[model samples]
Target: MGLLLKTLFYSSGFIIVWAMVGYPLSLKLIDRLYKGEQLKKDYSIQPTVTVMVVAHNEEKVILEKMNNILELDYPQEKIEFLVSSDNSTDRTNEIVTKFIKEHNERRIRLFEVILRKGKTNAQNEAQKTVTTEYLVMTDANAMMDKNSIKELMAAFTSNNIAYVTGRLSIVNQYVNEVSISESRYWDNDLAAREIEGRIQTITAGNGAIYACRTSDYYDFNPIQCHDSAMPLFYALQGKRAICNHDAIAYEKAGEVIKDEFNRKVRMSRIILKHILPDINILNIFKYRWFSYFYFGHRTCRYLLWLSHLIVFVTNVFLIKESWLYAVTFTAQVLFYLLGIIRGVTKANNKQLTMIYYYCMTIAAQWVGVYNTLTERTKPFWEKAESTR
Candidate 1:
């Protein structure tokens, strides 16, 4: 029993530490070894494209988003806008209608759903109405740069590339501990995507700003996350999904920790319920490099909470065996205790706050997994208030 507990403690601790630190370091090293060069942008090849914005009660930001789309550097004649409203009770549909009437020449079209389905369902319906060679899908709240589309389209210089996702920047106006931690997380995520793109292809796309070939687009399961599902589909079809760092979109980070935790919980359920069932993705022998990276970068991330929990429980059992184990066990307890203190006091220590946020996020994932197993979680969509 003692040997078994010690072995489990060391193994789980190693996985947790590797995922937290070694994974990012390894990406940086691999990027340097197999550096990739970007293809030259060809301004002459202007293909017709459709910009799809999936919205649900987004009246506050719809008008600004329309203006942003109209002001894009891409040719207006070649661009078509499709804004889908998922049975929004608010003035979201009216706002989109008004925009379409005002900008008739911009080719802006609106699709409304009487029954409220999720964003994925709305997007799946919108794809059927597209009449362009390329499709760009973005969130209604994401304010895109003038040259975002231009940069995204530039990556399609090769027919082998199926999709290209832009960088999503989280700009926090009222900076708090949660916002600071989230900003750092996104920066590291962007770096990972860029490195993965250089090595082979990115594991997933950012729905905030991503473009794909219209011919390659497929209807996604309404319950699945389009950002993850679409890129995985492209990979299965033997096509490349790369990140275009120059193409940028901006949105605010969640100001509240609870809101962020709920969002992660929702995403965790989606990954477990929908993503994991796709057995073809786990067949590493067939996909080779993509499968290796997908398991290491994405699968490991989703299972991190399990490893964290295992390390904690096993450390408790092994603390009496050695001083090293005792020290580790003490450190874990202290870290979590500090997290609890910060949570209760609403303190502003950056390092301590991040530790608290990480612990809470893991707890959220565990709750998500439990809810998923018990069939307590639903596929309904609710926009995070703080992010808006």
Candidate 2:
């Protein structure tokens, strides 16, 4: 039992260290290899692209979404908008139908699917209708910059590129201190750097805007989360799925603090059940970076403050044996705990509110794991306006 515990401590410690060091090292290596390289552009041969949106009860902002897509700079003849209502009870379908009817003469092809389920079902239903060479999946609330489609298409210049993901900027930063801090967590911190560098696996942002070859796209089981499963499945196929820094889509963050917590819970459960569990061991060996990302970016993030406990207990034993080991372990635990504390407190004007927010995120992850393991049923979408 002592030997087993020691092995767990050592393995967990090495995994934590490798994850931190590997992220930057992977960035540096990819940058060195792809130096002076830019996305290849092919203006002469315009490939057909379909912009697919899966929405439900999004009447409040569905029109804004359509208007944003309609304003993209891509060729009208080359772009198609495949809109699915996903069994919306609100005026989401009616609004989109009216827009499509009015703009029928234009190049946009707007189709609706009314399903009694979540985004995964809507996306899978829309997949059959995509007749274009490439398909871009985006959320109803996701706002595309004028150049987003063009930038996404440029990455497809290499035939080996199976999919291209985008960066998300939270438009409603002033919503709340928690929402604002969450936005910064992505925009100002790790996400921005991950997108800028090459050989990306998974990124945490809107999960709203991503493009892929129509042939390469797979159906995510309705129970599965689209963002978590799709890219991971693509990775298993040994194809390059990239993150396009220039492909920017802006979206509103959660309406309030509790809304943000609910969102994290849903995301955490999906990552644990679908993404981390079924990953092929051989593929994990090949893309060890992604393996680390799965654990660091998704899995261990839930353990939260308990990570400090693990470090303290394990190192106390190692302390008498080697002072260097003790010092190194102490520094790592202090740095991460500090980051977590600062991240939480920064959510509001009060010094301690950031701590509350940090604990909230961590607690939400545990709730998610519990719900996932016990097979608890939770609604896919939340009534954010009601939360406000």
Candidate 3:
């Protein structure tokens, strides 16, 4: 029992400390990379790029999305469009077929796959369908900014660029319930900005709203969190995943609090399925100060929250050092309860609200570990159902 408690204390303490230490290191690393040196100068030639969209039961919105792409200023010949329905039971197929037939003369080419390979498989299959040198993946619900593709292509000038992520703007936040719901839950606009401004890392990748080279395409595990996993994988390999703030895509946000919560939980599951134990030293150098900061600033910090829960629970009855264990466990529970109260109030102070939000986020992470461990698979995509 003493040995077990010792292990728990040491493990939790290490996680907490490591999470804090990683921040300053990441900042120093990012500073070095940003010093008068740009990697985009290497890709001298503009290469062929393909646009891929994965949709499931997006009958009402797919047509409008296709139209938006057609309005892009890029030469249709240099850019291609590939969209897959992934076993959609709605009129999604019919809508796509009509667009293909009507716009066959244009540079747009449409293909449909009926199998439900999840988002990752759909993206992989889309990559296989095209031999283009570059590939951009956008969501069916997202509408790209007029110059988004153009700006993204400009960044490829840096030869070291593997994957590029864009900004996602929730369209019409004024009155839409979905937009309002998103502003409070699931959406990471401010968090994304903080990451970009401080560490140059954007966690969202705006989902299907970003562009990357076909060669950099990685066949990640199907259930893995696509956005976070892909960028982190490349970043770990010592390449910077440039976050393009100017390149924007407008999409509908979650319509209700429940919808938003479900999206977060689904995303939480995906994240747990993917975060690996391996630590990359190259990632430390490539991102430099910011990378270290980000790992500490974001990634490692959350892991500590998970450790806190495990440690608190184990120390309760397993440790003979009752006073010390009780004190630590009590502190953890109190902080968590305070976070929950702050999160529930939804106050107007953005800073305090964000603090609450971050705390709740860690709480959600704990839930993720539990769900992942207990073999729970909430079948339907939570956010998608509302979008439908």
Residue 78 Cα positional deviation in candidate 3, in Å, after optimal superposition = 1.1
TM-scores for every candidate against the unseen true structure: 0.95, 0.79, 0.75
In terms of TM-score, which candidate is strongest? 1
lDDT of 2 by residue, 1-388 (tens): 5565466567666555544455446555656674624445554545899998877888988899999999999998889888877788888888888898888876555556654667777788878978999898888778899888988888676776677777777787777776666766666444424533254455332467888889887877777775656656766666656677778888777756777888877776654554356555236568655655555554555444345456557766666567776786777676557657765555346434454566676577677767877888453666466222
What overall lDDT goes with each candidate model? 0.83, 0.68, 0.65
The superposed Cα distance between candidate 3 and the true structure at residue 141, in angstroms, equals 0.7
Count of clashing pairs, candidate 2: 4
Q: Cα deviation of 50 in candidate 1 (Å)?
A: 0.7
For lDDT, candidate 1 versus 2, the one ahead is 1
By lDDT, the candidates rank as 1, 2, 3
Candidate 3 residue runs with Cα over 4 Å from true position: 1-45, 172-204, 270-275, 281-294, 301-305, 308-360, 377-382, 385-388
Q: What is the lDDT for 115 in model 1?
A: 75
- Tell me which residue pairs clash in candidate 1: none
| Model 2 / residue 269 / CA error / Å | 2.1
Q: Model 2: how far is 241 from its true place, Å?
A: 0.8
What is the per-residue lDDT of model 1 for residues 130-208, given as tens digits with 9 covering 90 to 100? Answer: 9899999899999999999888898887887888999998889348889988888888888888877766678877879
